[model samples]
Target: MSVHEEISKKTNKTWGIIQTYRKLDEKREAEIEKVILQCQNNEAFSVDQINKVTEEINSFAAINHLPSRKFVTKQMVEEAAQN
Candidate 1:
């Protein structure tokens, strides 16, 4: 391939990464909301429950190579659910 073609290919790849990052960020926020709602309806709101949800999200992020949202504690869930 020509130098110009190679540069264009890399530019497209960079753009794809940016778009994927944006989409993943939005998805992560939605996932957090879903987790909070699940906890709100559950019988008990505990640290373990929060940790389980956090781990699930983090695992998903890991697979996607996105930064994990650490420290999703029970208190954060409780406060977010109220809003």
Candidate 2:
């Protein structure tokens, strides 16, 4: 899968886990923070340093916010236009 697809899948799964936990709230807690912790523990994502960093950055802002847009260079766009 592409990076965008993977990010979307992870984002959705994170939301699903958070929602499920919300319904079973026996004790009140920071739901978003809890979900992020659970995601951080997953072996599929935590094994690679780069992946872990990306996951943490995205997960920490998954709720009530969006990831900041990255700057694109003119050369980057021109290169893409050549494809």
Candidate 3:
């Protein structure tokens, strides 16, 4: 399978996992939303930076079946683009 296909499959699986964990209660969903907002509001990451970082991390995770910590660096992006 192509990298894009692999990524799509992994993302679908992950979303399924998330959906399974979602509660029917509004309070539960609100709590989850609060945590998500807190993380997104972190001073270190602007909205654009967060989106970029999340995309790269998810891309790497989906492609490699690894955690975000193992994501390729900016240098790797440059190198890959140059090739």
| Per-residue lDDT of model 1, residues 1-78, tens digit only | 999999999999778866766665566566667778777787454455445555665676677576776656767887
lDDT tens digits by residue: candidate 2, 1-83: 89999999999987976664444332222333343454545422122333334454445446536452223333433343344
Cα lDDT tens digits for candidate 3, 1-83:
99999999999988865453332223333433444454445422123433444555456555646544232344443343344
Clashes of 3: 0
Mark the 10 consecutive residues where model 3 has the least summed lDDT.
20-29
* TM-score of every prediction relative to native: 0.52, 0.31, 0.29
Clashes of each: 0, 0, 0
Clashing pairs in 3: none
- lDDT score for residue 80 of model 1: 80
lDDT of 2: 0.44
Give me the overall lDDT of model 3: 0.47
Which sections of candidate 3 miss by over 4 Å? 24-83
What is the lDDT, from 0 to 100, of the residue 9 in candidate 1?
A: 100
Question: Largest lDDT belongs to which candidate?
Answer: 1
